[model samples]
Target chain A: MTDELVLRLLARLHGHAGWLAVAALLHPVIVLRSPMRRARGAAWASTLLVSAVAGLGAGLYPSYRALLKQAIFQQNPTVGWWFERKEHLAVGAVTFAWIGLLCHLAAARADSTSQKRLAALAHRAYAAAFFLALSVATIGTIAAANRSF
Target chain B: MTARSALTAASAFAIVPLAYAAQRCVEVGLGGELDPALVPPSPRIALFWRVGVSLVLAAGSTGPFYRLAERSPALALRVAEALAALAFGLLVAQAVFAP
Candidate 1:
């Protein structure tokens, strides 16, 4: 019971962090779209949050497999694959956010022409990150709804 | 975009393929699942090595790419693009032709 409770709590925290990460990822998208070129704070926050949230999910995976994987597949086979797809998309999310961050940092130091191009790339990258992160959160919720630890 | 920006874009894009490659690494090489065929993971690979390490390597590689771009922007651009293309191709091949 204690172990179950711990896994449950960790799962809840992971879900919450995933949502927070989605929001954080959006921050860079919005900030970059605006006249303000500031990206360090929000960009860093999003990248760190997404990476940590992904890490937390990793921490919970063993428990999830032991406790819930079979039940989830039994209940709905497709949801199981959706869960896998979620993981794949999460990889994309992390990459997009990292890409955005790298570009934003480089944009600050480059010449004006390069800066403009880098910043534009950052904006697009963050937007893609935000979209993928949101998709992951949604898929996660659906997966958990089917069966959760 | 300048050569440096080209390198940045290519390096950044490398993250996806790199992360997927990392997951494949531990799953196939170390987990005793040496099937030698690209397939979706059983329950997904550990994100630490998959995502975290890829993020670090892709991000770190950019620094060298930037310096190289400084000396030979055109060469750096070509190398970065080629590497990124290669990685992307490997990722696609794996995804599409999984046994």
Candidate 2:
């Protein structure tokens, strides 16, 4: 029963992953082109949703480990700290990425300069989010590795 | 900067806390769970930080800068540039003082 449950969960996760990958590929092209841009906008939204799911999946493992470390050892706090901070950063990154993709898609479909500006803003926001996440993750990883565990 | 441009800026500032907040290490007692026990239950400081962060994020979400991004490539580029700078700063800080 346990094995069956695990398999079902894994299968669901894989399905979601496939969707996210497709959306990720489709979104950027939609940003540049027309007509298809509307369809792509929907895809972008879906992709962001999948990204959030994937991120949570990725986070769970580290979080679980952190919980174990805190519970058993109770001596070091580095890994646990890293886990939490990384999750927050990941959330921010995805939010920005979605916003950017949405803006870009809308701008591509738009005919006005003002609409284009919105697209650009979204791109900037996404980039900022990505970098912010990268920094936090990198630092946390290093800190955890060097920590007195 | 127009409304959308302003939102972008707000969003950037809102995210800045993520960098600094991650760096903060509050010494606390582990409770074998996600919640750690801080030595002192000082709600004021915690409240202040949460409020400040909420303001930043709220500004980004509610401001006009995001809307402006749809139209102005220049504004978008400018905001992107600023965020890039922030990202760089955050990376350096994390790398240098992470431990």
Which of the numbered candidates is closest to the native, going by highest TM-score?
1
- Provide per-model DockQ scores: 0.17, 0.11
lDDT, residue A85, model 1: 59
Per-residue lDDT of candidate 1, residues B2-89 (tens digit): 4366555656566555567546544545553322123333565454446666766777777777778778645654564455445544
**Candidate 2: TM-score, chain B only:** 0.37
For residues A1-149, write the lDDT of model 2, one tens digit per residue.
Answer: 67446644653563455345444534443443442233445436544664665455453343334334344224445554554455444444554555555555555544475455555555455554446445444544454444322
Q: Per-residue error at A93 for model 2, in Å?
A: 1.8
lDDT of each: 0.69, 0.46
- The candidate scoring highest on lDDT is 1
Point out the worst 10-residue segment of candidate 2 chain B by lDDT: B25-34
Q: Cα deviation of A93 in candidate 1 (Å)?
A: 1.0
- Cα deviation at A89, candidate 1, in Å, is 1.0
